[model samples]
Target: MKLSSIIFIWGMLLCSSLNLFAQQTDFKNFETRESTLDERWELTSESSQGTFVVVPYKPIYILPGRWSNRPNKLPTSLNPDNVAKIPNDYNNFEARFQLSIKTKITSGLLFGKGDIWLGFTQTANWQVFNEKLSRPFRELNYEPEVIFNYPLPSDASIFGLKPKMVGLALNHQSNGKSLPYSRSWNRVVFHAAFEYRDLSFTIRPWIRFSEKFDTDDNPQIGNYIGVGDATFVYTHKEQVFSLLVRSNMRLNNRFKGYADFTWSYPIKGNLKAILQVTHGYGETLIDYNYKQTTVGLGVSLIEWL
Candidate 1:
């Protein structure tokens, strides 16, 4: 069965398990509520009698190529002044999960909204430049994110403002034992999102800032200043289309750009799936041109509490 179908079954099982636990409770003061836990999300409603969660699995393909810079055809060390070099066949694979969690608060807060997740990401880059090694570069990361949403009254839009939300994320990466120069990196990112919604349309814009630090530099490649990244997400729900453009600026004067297009469709109930293609380009370690492209199919586990 497909990943989505499997997740639905797992969620049902979890709900049933929670119900059994509730019935076995001896204290009358304690109440049993439904809870959900999956690869995508684990959620529980405050007044709910049980839990409901969903897990989504994604199989993705990534193609990172330097069409203008070939590893074998060019000099061992690239010379930026020379423009006649061929491109390289650098490709990679990525498995990604987008997850979330939501629970109603019993006290203090009036509004209810949960967290967002970038989920689990594993990327492997096949280096055409060095074919003799066991591998080129492999990385795995699990980064769960949290988002807080605060809705503003309609009159707030008159001042060119809309509902605002904030998000925070922590990402930790582990470079497998392949390249001798393997090093780990940790990053903390903060985001602020704003949304404008009317009866017929919705527009959302968000900005993110991040800082990365090196953990163990076994090879002793000194660390540099932090980096900054920002993105703009535009969506037209009526047309089932979304556009995402992201740019990262480094203190060392290097920058990366990402452009993506997505088409989405409803799969079952509140769940939706999206197919996307992302094109990226940036500066390599030697300042040579670096390019990457990826095509992926993703499932969005959606809910409104």
Candidate 2:
């Protein structure tokens, strides 16, 4: 059977299971738990690769609330468990993979809490693109990054009237090879986020800043001051939408932006189906663009526990 058919069937099963469970038990009567897994897959298009994101949360114990990096994970859509190959075309015919895992430690605060985080990711690429010919030339490049986010604070004003939250993060990325095709530089990044919740919506707005240093000390583009990025996300039951904008001086005065939408529903049992669309400019790695539209549908192996 085709993969799409399989995913559809599985999602239906999950929805069925959830309905049955909800009917037999009084979810409202039960107390909320501290730890939960809200893992899910958001598919865009068959032509575009898929992303599986796992978001895990721990109850508000040491900290007023919880903190995660997207605290979410994405694998390839085809396998969902494995990293997938990046699609290539005449404008972008290259191979690259990047993954970042973050761990957080926390301390209690008066309004909310504080956390320290660490993460790293890297990607290398080789591509040949030709607009006129069947095959194109080749270029090579790679970058690896590791960074630490020190303790940041939050409060009721930050989380909304409901609770308070504040956060801070530091980030850095460096190119590994000196292939003239790739730009090599080290960057220092800073991030801050404020969150608020209303009866129907949860919103998070974040800002990021970065400074770059050229490893080769190239005068033309080396050691340039960096660009900054800002992002906002709003989530309602079964729906999530977000926007991100970034400016980079290194890319010939290029500006990038992305808008994304995701909707999910349970079909039956412990299965669920999700639909997603991401539009961007500059690069998919940074934002959603129309040059590519990724449509995907996926089923959960099990209910979110």
List, in order, the clash count of every candidate structure: 15, 32
Top candidate on TM-score is: 1
In terms of lDDT, the best-performing candidate is: 1
lDDT by residue (tens digit), candidate 1, 195-241: 44411122223232232322232211111111333333333442245
For residue 8, give model 1's deviation from the true position in Å.
17
Report, for every candidate in turn, its global Cα lDDT versus the true structure.
Answer: 0.36, 0.31
